[model samples]
Target: MGSWERPYWESTVDSGVPRAAQRSGAYRRYLPDAIDGMALAIDGDLSRDVAVVERKLRALNGPGAEGLAGIARFLLRSEAIASSRIEGIAPSAQQVAIAELGQSESVRGVSEQAQLVANNMTIVREATTELVVADKVAVEDIVELHRSLLPNEPRHHELRTVQNWIGTSDWSPIDAAYVPPDPDRVVGLMTDLLRYLNGAAHAPLVQAAIVHAQFETIHPFTDGNGRVGRALIHTVLARRGLTEQAVLPVSLVLATLTDEYITGLDSYRHDAAPGSPPAGMAINAWLRTFVTAAEIAVEQSQQLVSAIEELRERWTERLAEYRMAAGLRAAPRADSAVARVLVHLPEAPVLTATTLARILDVSYPAASAALDELRQAGVLATKSIERGTTAFIAREVLDLVTWSERALASTRFDTRRAEPVRPVPARPQR
Candidate 1:
């Protein structure tokens, strides 16, 4: 059974702190049950719900899905962005893209927040790839993920040795909304959590929900717990082969349902015995929220796939018009640099000639020519990113990316139908 313990909180800071923050008191810290060997009883209706969403997930990764290669690339960014947004790290999709470019090259006007979100993308990608391939995850793997998420913050890279709380004064755990198990219990709890992850006792979605909820409850790291917990969602799905090529972007749905998300986590933290009715109900409720988010993610992904395909078709028409106006006799060859660049636009919506060459495995001159040809066709816009480097922007693709962000923020998944529940990027200028 999981229960809370009343622990004495000793304040270590006093300068400029409020009296309440500087005072010592006893705080309730939750200690969750070890999930290893726990038998979960999911009823028939909820089982059916899980099956439906799993089917949808498999379909989204199906062979016939359009622009999946491109969708896979950008959807990773979307997932990272939404996950960060849930932590109040909001950055426009454009700013994030620029920060990504800034990672390797000089780009002016990138915000620190955007850079942090960009780092988050790397962490999310690593979670899906590295953790998925590991034969068995260790506690160190989770710590490494947190380290990657906060690369510059050396103090937070390891499991916290001191007490931490979710909401309240930062100086102490006094009157905190949620305090995790004491630091000494973190390593043991995490070991049990990984034991459950290494085994496949439940449905993929069910296991993912339990793993994520358990991780958040444990709150092992001093910082980046929410982001790491969300990333674990991907690790579970990918290791189970539910999402092979593309991310599910469930965080996009969760960001819209922030209140419900918190409530679900709270319910998962209930202090009932593991096999008791209240415990079953609490886990079931959290599973329903997760399943619904997965379903919505699949639906929104289909819409994005179709939208990207349509945009590609429009690009073809523009290229054809440009070719005719320039008196060119034949379309670009399928294996030509121009065609290859066009196909890769969604994956690399903004790229410099140097980077494009590396991405396409072509010569620098060839990549530059392909970019220039696309720019002439008005399929791409060129921006001077540095003193000598020029970047090609697939504005149409980025517009759709921005629109998808706005749509995800909206309750109806369509901005015109419902206003966004949270702030989103402004519409791209024509």
Candidate 2:
């Protein structure tokens, strides 16, 4: 292992029997030259391998891109759900949260975190749309994008604060690890990194890898660093217009490859030589691993999208057997309406007639009747309720929809000839 001078943050922690043993003596030197080279690799023209991947992605158009897009939406939705739940909000309440977010002309609420995520999704969509035609994007725009994602979250917004890292030392049981550079250094480091991100000397994917690693190493935020860091990947990719719709679920990939994900960051912190200079080899290894993960993520997402489309077709065929009112059919397509409602039920399984009426945009009687039909079909079950409020629960529809979407997105396809979905034939006006 390479040794280097310990950062001041590492020196300030108490070293008594209580905390001394927890400190890690392992320090890795970061070479600025390595960072520059890595930055070049990130901004450089697309490599043959990346171009091949891009062509493959483009060929995998239409259902393929749609599938990937669906997966991206779902994964992001899931992340928001998980993060909100972690912050003490119940999953079922997400509807209210989302509804409030959607209806409010202005973004303002106690659910600031959730709103930030929603905004991030919007920015990501816009950036992805623009990327399809652009060759490169400004790094300042990325910083602004990050700012937009968390403008209200104090510790996470645009500033870095003093914080302690945790690790285990040989003699110390467990203690604070290295203290990062002061705010000035952190900003300078990030500026350099962003310059690398915006430059044209490296592949976008490679840049994503190096930048992600460097951002984490910088530990720029006092909290929410991980989440924001992950968001940066989507920002860069979307800005670069790499994927169709910026549909990659990098977090999903990172979440699954938790071991390597953590190790990659650890390797950067523990393996590189101290004070010698940044080593391109160490960063490159991490980039290659990230690219591999991304490729896998894309394949998996494509498959998931294909599976979802197939399942949706099957569901449509099944639904066709019933001569339901056109108005009912007009209720937002199942995935957009019913599936969204059902996913929240793991926490609050009981949906009252009033709530159903609002959610489905039908009269209370109509909503209640629809519930009865669903219940009779064994797709929903009833639970105890008070007053005139009837509570109904969705069955396995949520799982079916979610998993099918994943399967379709993971399947690969030909991008060049693939076209966007043609407009559906219009039904006769009543």
Candidate 3:
């Protein structure tokens, strides 16, 4: 049965700590049931719904899709950014791209929030890719993932030694809306969680929902729990082979369904007997919510794929027009730098010539010429990164990224009728 224990909090009166936090008292800490062997009773209708969404996700990652790999990269970034935004680390997609550009070369005009989101993007990519290939996901593996997510925050790199709570007093767990297990219980719970993750006892979507909810319940790390928990959703999908090329961006939909999302998690944390009908219903309700979010993710991501493909077609026509006006007799060879750069623009929308040369394995002059050609053709725009170092951006790609973010932010998936519940960056200026 899910249970709770009253742990006495003898608060230390640290400087600047609130006086209320100094009062010593007993607070309840939840101890969630180990789920490695838990039986989940899902109805047939819900089972079929989950299976249909799984098929859609697979089709989205289907082999031979043009620009599949690049689109996957873009979606991965979108997922990371949305996940970070859910934690209130909102940053413009373009700013995040520039922050990513900063990783390759000197850059300016990027914020710390953008860089943090960029770090999230990197860790999400690494987690989904690396965790899928590991023989077994160890406790250390999950710890390392947290470490990577918070490279600058040393205290958060390890499992939290002190108590942490969500909402209410920042100084103490007093009156907090939710409190996870005691610090001493963390490793054992995490071990059980990892064991479940390494197995395939449930359907992909069901398993992902349980894994994510369990991780959030454990709240293992003092910080970054939300981002790490969301990354695990993608990891579970990839490991189960449901997603091989594209991330579902489920967090994007979840962010818009914040109230339902929290309520679902709350239901999952019920004190009912783990084997009782109430327990089954509790989890099943959460599964329905998660499955719905997954369905929305697939539908919206499909639209993004279509939008990107359409943009690619427009670039091709514009390139043709530019070449015709220049009086060139034939198109640039398929393997030429211009062609290669165009192929990769979806993935790497912002680039420096130096970065492009390294990415495409071409001569510096060749990459520079390709950038010049694409810029002249109106397929790319130039932005000053730093003195003497200009970064080229595919504004349309960045705008699409912004639009996707905004679209996901809205409850309706259309910004025209609904404003975002969270702050979404305005569309980039042309």
Candidate 4:
């Protein structure tokens, strides 16, 4: 809403109009400076918020961070759920977990929304991992990410050639909420974006914010732009060495304030006249929102970490009681069945005796006994029993997951936590 102006060029278009040609105003070939032409000095509050978030993240990844990273799988799953929720696809944590581990029956009907959430889990994991070790983030890496998100779709790995717009069923930008610069500008703007992302032109947090907002404004892909834009948030932070092995579920917070989020993004589309003072106002607004959301994510993440640690201690106490009750003459094996199964729970919460048997490479009775012991310990509860298969729910973990996810949806948890039966596929032993 500030007096921001950006250059524009005239273009011919006719997709939504039944005419030979219609002149349209297209954003001119644009190249934003590292901070989107904004001075960092213009926003001290933003800088301070970024610092606090970074400090909390460092602490979150510190030594007290023990056992938290083990739940990185769950954190990534939470991120996927939230990212997908922003696009109006709400998949339960358990459903997404099942989908991620390549199991389907646990999720009934496998709604397109659930499937998309599952796909996002794959996209986020792949993008974050790739960016963590790469020196630079490439356009192809982004394109591949889009491809992975929208598998089997045309132009999945390519930028849009056809025109697209938001806020209307009709593809006319005339009444669109906002129009991106054009298909021809896709590569050029993307090139500019990658340059900013690669260089140390701004603080890592500021850079990450600019990268995400710019990508959203660019709307490069034919579809999956939102998911891809969100993925870039992780990529930028990872490439900048902000995060190591964890994916913060920041979108969950944004998802909770959908109206404010859209308004912030709309504010981010502001620009200034050519050769005028840099337009930092809108960038500042967006950065504040992003940073606050990230800070909340960190705080909530710490709570969950504590909850998991407490849960683990309770499991240990029960296991110790089991050891005593089992009349073991000496200490139970360090790699005892309960310990091994407990180690496996955070990775795959929903499992049956058979899957547990295979995953732990133990006999069915041994696996079943361990499961029964944990269930008796009140760690897992019976979810379902059908045709020789009995499924157990890691109820406590799901409670925390549902609390966070339902918070994102701005609603109470509707369904009970009764959910997965497979170990997540191993990453080639890496």
Give residue 270's lDDT in candidate 3 (0 to 100): 75
Worst lDDT 10-window in candidate 1: 63-72
Candidate 2 residue runs with Cα over 4 Å from true position:
1-4, 8-52, 59-61, 81-157, 161-163, 166-182, 267-278, 323-397, 400-430
lDDT of 2 at 283: 57
Per-residue lDDT tens digits for candidate 4, residues 1-430, read 1232244434556566654235555332333333334345537767877888888876777643545554545545644554554454355666655554445344444456656677776666766677657777778878877776666565555987755667643434554566666577678778778877878778777787788888888788867787778778877776776666565666656666567778888767665566543456767788888887788777777876777777777878876776677775333476867778876676568788877888889998998988998887677877553545667777666556655444434422122332111112111211
How many clashes does each candidate structure show, in the order listed?
0, 52, 0, 3
Task: Please give each candidate's TM-score.
Answer: 0.87, 0.60, 0.87, 0.75
Candidate 1 residues 1-430, lDDT tens each?
6787888877777779888888988888899888998877887899998998898888877642536545445545644555454455467666677788887778887787777778778666766589999999999998888777666668888888977898988888878889999899988999999999999989999999999999999998888788788788888998998888777778778879888898888888767545554777778888888888888888888788778778888888989899889998447889889988887787778888888888889999999999999999999988787788888888887778778778888888888999888877777787
Which one wins by TM-score: 2 or 3? 3
What would the TM-score be for candidate 4 when compared with the true structure?
0.75
Q: Candidate 3, residues 309-383: lDDT per residue as tens digits?
A: 788889988888898899974378999999888878877888989999999999999999999999999999999
| Clashing pairs for predicted structure model 4, backbone only | 5-271, 5-272, 350-420
* Poorest lDDT segment (10 consecutive residues) of candidate 2: 419-428
Off by over 4 Å in 3: 6-26, 63-91, 106-120, 171-174, 273-277, 329-331, 386-389
- Please give the CA lDDT of all the candidate structures: 0.81, 0.51, 0.83, 0.65
lDDT of predicted model 1: 0.81
lDDT of 1 at 79: 49
What lDDT, from 0 to 1, does candidate 3 have?
0.83
Q: Give the TM-score of candidate 1.
A: 0.87
